[model samples]
Target: MSTVNDTKFSFAVFFLTGIPGQKDVHVWISIPFCLMYLISIVGNSVIVFIIKTDPSLHEPMYIFLSILAVTNLSLSISTIPIILGIYLFNSREISLDTCLAQLFSIHFLQCTESSVLLLMAFDRFIVIHDPLRYASVVTLPRIAKMGLVCVLRAVAVVVPLLFLLKRFQYGRANVLSHSCCLHQDVMKMVCSDITVNNIYGLFVKILTMGLDSLLIFLSYVMILKTVMSITSHTESIKAQNTCVSHLFAVIVFYTPEISLSVLHRFGKGSFPLIQILLGYITLLVSPVLNPIVYSMKSKHLHANIIKAFFK
Candidate 1:
């Protein structure tokens, strides 16, 4: 039972492996990763810019979406330096402090994104169940407050990881499986008892991702119930259609995340490169696709996007 107070490895350094076993193709692999990162930054930036300029998009749904875009941008930005370092420069050595900082930022952004999605779900619920009060209930101040809470909660939950990780003494090879530093990946290198790290990691996952997912599910269930009660089939379809983009966004965000989680926890037979691919997908897909999905699906946003580009 190694306690956190026993060891303090403040200055340890870890080497990052860029797609283990596929070292020969790292440069080739980096092509797509770089492309995706570029697209995500451009796409999400455009979304945020469009939302800020268009007063018409000053609604709760778009506001929450802007938060998601910002979170995706943060996630993409946080990983780029280290990932690109591994792929392009073969610079795999990262200081302990840098690794911990990256780990915290990555998870914090993930938690914030999850929280934003939950707020989006709540927005949909209000719009469906109480359309009359939608504007009043989801006001600008309230949305701003919700966004603040989301960010604050993410910070609060991830800050403890810094304390927990600092206590571990990394006596192993100190090599990470992924190009980017992840809490689970880093914890595996520690020589001391990792029971606290494991438990805390699980607790954070359940607290942030687990709880948000459950609420989002329940929201959609209620949304479906409301849609089903409509007298006209066309009306029901129309009501459900509003959620199509959000549903796609949710699927895009969670599928890769769940797959990555499964790979890390249970997919021992899976190749290391396969896990790394999933890691890339988890980081890249949502950020790249989210703004595109919203822009293609929302007529107002699409029009604004065109106007912004051509005007």
Candidate 2:
């Protein structure tokens, strides 16, 4: 047993438990995780490559799509090493600094994805509501600036978490529930009072994920209103068709996350395996699904992918 003062500012390592009570079959579990990571990496990378090499895709919408792919890849890359290590190599011990870095990168990339989706919504809204000014309003330079601001905003919000968590003395068992480090999970191990950490974590969640989800919803509502007002039924259908991919992406991205967060926060007494499974789904599902969804929905992208592969 460790004491507070003894470990104060002296904590240096954390042991990651991949999934509680599933140790015997951790190897079997890695099979699906490895498959998902491979698919996500390849799928998102293909999207980025297609968008970059195709001259016709140099528009705001596809630009945002490329950014989404890049963000998904970042998210997957951020978490994969530790996940593979824990499951395959039995390397569960992560240095304090490494854990902190992983925690920051994972959360930062998640927040950036949310922001990019929000920007995608805005792009759709502009194109649909004011098609005449779409090109002028959402210029390449503006999109570049928007991506920069999204990353900077995530950094601004997540950097404080590092400082806040660092101030605490974690003298308890530093075993994490998931393969990857998360702000909330790591905070639970601190020996000192973590009231501020909890409160601020909730605040940051509401500020980033909560608020972004709300705005994305509102953007779609407005989009629906505009689409319905279109005189031609064919035009309305086309407009709605443009949103199918994004809508699917948003659903996969938020549903698992919201469910996992709720389960962690309030679903006490839930099965540990269920919680661990949900955590993996939340982290892995969207990246693997997003590019596939987009490719299936967007005829142009789909054709481009097929052409690129077959040619």
Candidate 3:
């Protein structure tokens, strides 16, 4: 019902979602996110540096792994700093422009991560099914192109959501349960009809989240099939070893995300703190685990991280 020109440019809005909690709650939560952010940056940075610097890992799998690590870095960089500000300053306020921009970047990084994950799955499939062709097929040019595609796909759709949001009237201002900007938070105040927004969001989930997950599942299935066909026990073991770490990282990252979605929809009576913690665990906390999972599973990476820290 609202027009573009009628939408007000919001000054600043508070971000404290849910009923305000005690000082101890803020301290405890902030400390955890701060530490996780530090670890995530250092871990993902070293993974990227190692992948770039080491000639031994110049293969397609490691290249995609490096890309994934970098994407995680992007995710962490955007979410954690704003969250830290909200907690430390006790000021959850964000400008309307800033909020939309943050939403844009968050979705961009998220979609990029999802698409990159799918591409990595395809990379695994190629490595397993046609090891000889992987280096040529997933070359730097192709990888770069795929990266562009992923980022473009992400930005293309999310930018429009802002226009859609702009069509809504801001009946209320500055009431967020969480520390950072989220789609649900922004939409909560819309006095106009938001059924279309919900539909668009659903479509996105089905296409990006659901479709990407299916491709990843299929890629692993093909990979498992190819692995099973290998006769040499030692080579078979070595072949599977390369992909197992990536597989583990994927499971850890997505499982919590899926669970959080289901819970938020189904668990209406859940406590405020519990819901907040789960949401953060799904996005912010999950990223911290990606590099750790990779390093723990990769002997070379584990050794390098340890050596780097010690030195």
Best by TM-score: 2
**Higher-scoring candidate on lDDT, 1 or 3:** 1
The collision pairs in model 3 are 13-93, 15-92, 16-176, 17-176, 17-177, 18-177
RMSD of 1: 2.8
Least accurate 10 contiguous residues by lDDT in model 3: 10-19
What pairs collide in candidate 2? none
Tens-digit lDDT track for model 3 on 65-134?
A: 8888998898889888887876676666677778788888777777778888898888878877998886
Model 1 lDDT per residue over 1-311, tens place = 35443333554779887766677888997898788889889999999999998999988888888889999999999997678888888999888888888998899998899998899888988898889999789888888788889889999989998899886677524878888888878887887898898788888888998899899999999998898788898978777877888888888877777777777767754677778778877777888899888999888899999998898
Question: By TM-score, is 1 or 3 better?
Answer: 1
Q: What would the per-residue lDDT of candidate 2 be over residues 1-311, giving only the tens digit for each residue?
A: 34656565575578987876677998998998899899999999999999999999888899999999999999899887679889898999887778889999989999999999999998889989999988899999999999999999999999999999777766434787777898878887887788898788889889999999999999999999999899999999999999988988888888878877777677763666777777788788889999989999999999999999999
Better of 2 and 3 by TM-score: 2
Tell me the spans in candidate 1 whose CA falls farther than 4 Å from its real position. 1-11, 267-271
Model 2: CA > 4 A from native: 1-8, 268-271
In candidate 3 the C-alpha lDDT for residue 235 amounts to 81
Q: Return the TM-score for candidate 3, rounded to 2 decimals.
A: 0.88
lDDT score, residue 274, model 1? 78
